[model samples]
Target: MTKAHHIIIVGGGAAGLELATKLGNKLGKKKLAEITLIDSSRTHIWKPLLHEVAAGTLDSSEDQLEYLAQAQWNNFRYRLGRVIGLDRESKELLLEPTLNDEGEEIIPERRFSYDTLVFAVGSLSNDFGIPGVKDHCLFLDSTEQAERFQKNLLNRMLKAHSQSKPIEQGQLHVAIVGAGATGVELAAQLHHVTRLVSAYGLDSIDPAEDIKLHVIEAGPHILPALPQRLSDAAMRELHRLGVTVHLNQRVVEINAAGIVAASGVIIPAAIKVWAAGIKAPEFLKDIAGLETNRINQLVVKRNLQSTRDESIFAIGDCAACPMDDQGNNVPPRAQAAHQQAMTLSRTLVRRLKGEPPLDYTYRDFGSLVAMGHYTTVGNLMGGLAGSMMVSGYIARFVYLTLYKMHQAALYGWPRAILISLLHFLRKGIDPQVKLH
Candidate 1:
């Protein structure tokens, strides 16, 4: 039999998994193409929810999707390994050997040939060469990191509650750098979770008094990328929740004890989180001679094809795609990634029939920052009606629908509804927050 057209997608992130599922359903199900997805990890979790995972508001163990099971159901093959090298000339990519916790190799180094390749390898927190930040600060880029933060948070809380001594200045203080959506929402979530923790038998530690959440932002306003109106609203909510917001404070260094600001301000913190900025992985820079941007993102054309090679395409945060002619690129957001996945799925299907590709256009549904169960705030961009600021239950409902939409895209509406129900049922029996 003639060999099927092999399509390989690297990175089992929001964009990569969605694209893989769609293409697998359209082509792989019919044996028209062989679909394979490669990732360093075996499970996938929505990137935006990492904050909740870190704060213990969301249990990642129940939410994370197993790539192997997903691949089996979606008619795609899942390979667990990191892409270390790419050879455009040979139409092949090399994966490093997969290793276990003890450093024993599981899968040997392998190379896979692809007739078409798509890169959706997401971005990571960029420290910008900040001194001691990497060594002292925790990041919420992955589930592993989030879980680590959660465990550390629980242990610290337990220790604080068990001790008869007074809480030290930095004992229960959490210093979060960057007041973007992640930092702001995390501050709010952690604040709410602290109250829950205190209520759940940790009464010795006062949520408002002992659990201090500090947000340090170099920008003049929180959520600098967002409108000033939304940022102001979020700030008000955060302040009401007793989160200390330090604006225009540039962090010069981070140490085991705390963060030092350029303005001679030092914030003592037992746990520090860095959510300052993001950049595509360093390895993507000019990989296989592909054009890359300053942030190491693959420079892709309007149709999402690499500038240097047509057979290779990139989407999601890894692809520096143009938004318009004004020298602007699409922002790295979940909505942008979702749109790219939808557009790329169509483009690939059309390519099978020798048809022209479809271009990806970002749709601004606005941004929502969910602050645990306290409240959700955001701006709603209605194309013709203009932007409207929303908060409270309406905004919370909209914020939740975004996640529901993602679930529907993956499992269809029925299964997504069932999954939602299962989560609801699980919440009744399980603690609101992860205890151990």
Candidate 2:
């Protein structure tokens, strides 16, 4: 029997998992190709939901998807390791040693060869060499980090509630850098959940008086990437939520005490969060001679293959695939990732069948920003009707549909429907916010 072509997908993120599932069903099930997915994480959680996890609004245990189980159901193999280096010439990858909590080696350094390699490693929070940001500020880039923030936030809340002393200047303050979607959404979520946590018998810390939330943005306005009208709407909503939105305030430095803005204002914060810009992993810049942008994102052609090699492809936040010659590239949105995954699934299938790969054209389905449980605001891209801004319940429904769409992609319609029902049932059975 002829050996099946090996297709190794690294990352297991939204793009990687979706691609693996589609291709696994299309090719692996038919014994056409051997599909394998690798990642440093044992489970996968949708990145957009990280804010919910950090705010204690969503429990990670309830939402995280285990890689081994998903692979078994989807007809792919799973490998737990981080790809440290790439050897394009030999079609091989080097994985770093995995260690346990005691610093003992759990998995030794290893190498894996592939016939076709797909990179979906995703991006991380870029500190831009900022002093003190790394040690002092919390990041929401991964589940572990989000959980750490969640636990710390809970502890601080408990301490403040139990104390007979008045809250210190920075004790109940939260300064969030970057007013992007993640930062903005998190600011709103923290406001809501903290108030809930306080209302649920933690009366010492007054949610309305003692607690403070600051959204520090360097840009002229929050949601700089979105339309000015939408940004204005979001700001209005945020203001009503009692959040202090600091506009045009560039963070010069961050410490345990607070953040110092370029304007020379010190915003004291007990818990600091950095949700600023993102860049691909540090090692990807010149990995195996692959072209990379200043942010270290792998540069790829329109077909989503690396500029230097066709056998390798990249998608999601890690790949810099141009949408046009004018230096425009696909936006790092979940929608774009989903579309790229669908396109690449077809691309890989066609390649195995000796057909030309199709070019990926990102369809802008607009964007949505949810303001916790209150409402959601965004513009929906209607094919011919141009773009129209949506808010309130309609927009909130659409915002939720995005995640439902993702669930449908991964688990199909039946399981997705059941999951939705379970979520509804959970509303009555579980606490509105995770207390522990």
Candidate 3:
């Protein structure tokens, strides 16, 4: 009797979940391969939607896909643990003990052996060792964190509305550190949704005038990674919406009530979110002798395999795969991960047949920044678009389509369509923002 190949995947983000589902449906269903997915969390939510989750514009529960449910529906076995160590020699991956809310260990440390291993553990915000950041700021790195921010925001809104005194300066101020897509989108969502919440019987608080948003970017402008044109458009929209843009101001320290800029400006804020940068979880740094970059991302060859092991592969933001001779690794974006997942899905099937894995070269289709219901701006690359700039409704439609594509990957087109319909219906039945 031949031994069934065991494939183990760590993490449950966009790349990890999609790859597991694909292999599980394709290989596990036939009993040719045993597929297992391990993630620290029991549920998976699209990372890009985290800003909406944080701003209370979207209820995370409505969108979260439970891993156990997904595993049962597909053929993959799901494990509730986080990979902490990897033994390449024994082909065993070590998992840290699972802890409950009270900090009691539920599941003890465990290890799983695999014929093939994949790491898509994703990333966390890089605080850059800034003092007080870890203790004071909320991050949108996970669903729980985003929901925490939402609840806190709701509490503040309710308190301000029910109180007799007028809202004071910085009482409702939100200081978002970083002008990247996450920071910018969050500012827009919070502004739009907070106002909507105020209208829903919290009429004592005027959303238009009560809330103050301060976006602090260390760079010269917002959306520093995107095209300047798109950045300018987004900047204009943010200003039009009354958002305060603080460019080239570096936050040196975060305190209980505010942050101090490098220029010694004290910005008072009720809430502070660090969305500046990302680095892979620290555990990835040289784990089991695997090569990694400065950001702790596993270094990969052109084929997306770890530099030290052919049996292991890395993808998404966790892998430092080079894009070209320009010393540019693939940008950590959802689109790049989406494309890489598709390519690697095919490559894995080929590998099972003793075929060589294919090399990856990223295709930069475009980038889009959605500013809530106001508008969207981005540029399209290649194929008839040729640097064509798109804005307003066209860009917004495209932005919505991106999420639809991710949904299709996980649930297939038929179910994705049904999900979309349900969300549309929900708009009429429920409030646009998460109030409670």
Candidate 4:
């Protein structure tokens, strides 16, 4: 009998989970390959929705998919463990022992041999070693972080509302230290949701009067990666929503009270959110002498295979793949990850059939910025014959379709349609923002 081919995937994120589902349905069902997905968490949530989760605009419990349930339904095996190291020579992945909240070992440290290994561990916030940042500032990199911010926000609002005296200084001040997509969206969403929260009988504290939002960026402008016109439109909308935009102001320190700019000026804030940049996990940098970029993304070839070992493949935010057009590198975005995942699915299938995997190319699908109910602005590339700028409700619709597209990729047409309908139906019954 032929030995069963084993494929080990580390990280059940957007890219990893999708790839696993596709492969499991295609290969695992036929017994052509054994597919296993390893992740630290038992649930999976798209990382892009983290901003919405952070602002309490989206309840995570309703949307989060259980990894175990998904794996069982999709014909894949799920292992709960953190990958600590890789043994390229031995073709084994070293999984660290998993512990429960009570400090008891849940899963023992073990090694999993694999014919092919794919790393899709994703990226995390890069604090850049700023003073007091790790302890004082919140990051929206994980579900826990976003939920923590949401809980803190609700508690702050409730405390202020219950106060017998007038609102004190710095009552609900939020300082977001980045004008990137995540920070900007969070700022706008907070403005819209906080007002909605106030309407639900948090009457003593007025959302507009008591809550203040400060968006700080070291760059000269917000949405620096987007076109100037779209960025300008976003700036205008943010200003209309009473968000203070601070440009060219680098945050040198994050204290318990607020953030201190490099210029020595201190901005008083009750909460601070850091969303400036991202870097692959530090562990990947020295992982078995693999070639990595400055941000610790594994250097992969055009075929998405690691430079050190072709058996090892990397994708999503963890891989540094070259851009064909500019000779630069692919940008880490949800779309890029989705595209790479699709490409790798086909490539892996071909490889299983004793065929060479094809090189992966990233296609630019343009970008969109959603600013809650205020507006959405974006440029449409690969849409018309040329690029076109879109704004307002139309842009908002397009922006939402992006998330739907992700759902379609993962769950197919029927499930995606049902999920979308369920979300819409829940909107009528639930408050727009989670007040508690």
lDDT per model, in order? Answer: 0.92, 0.92, 0.91, 0.90
lDDT of 1 by residue, 1-436 (tens): 8899999999989899999999989999999899999999989999999999998989998888999999999999999999988998999999988889999988899999999999999999999999999999999999999999999999999999999899887899999999999999899989888888888998899777788899999989999999999998898888888889999999999999899999999999999999999999988988988999889999999899999998999999999999999989999999889899999999999999999889888889999999778889899998787999999999998998988888888888999999999999998899999888
For every candidate, C-alpha RMSD to the true structure in Å: 1.0, 1.0, 1.2, 1.3
Name the lDDT of candidate 2. Answer: 0.92
Considering lDDT, which of the candidate structures 3 and 4 is the better prediction for this target? 3
lDDT of 3 at 408: 94
Q: Residues 290-345, candidate 2, lDDT per residue (tens digit)?
A: 89999999999999999998899999999999997798988888998899999999
- Checking candidate 1 for backbone clashes, the offending pairs are none
Q: lDDT (0-100) at residue 161 of candidate 3? A: 90
Candidate 4 minimal-lDDT segment of 10 residues: 379-388
Model 2: ten consecutive residues of lowest lDDT: 161-170
Across residues 344-413, which tens digit of lDDT does each residue of candidate 3 receive?
Answer: 8788888889999899899998889989878888887888657878999998888889899988999999
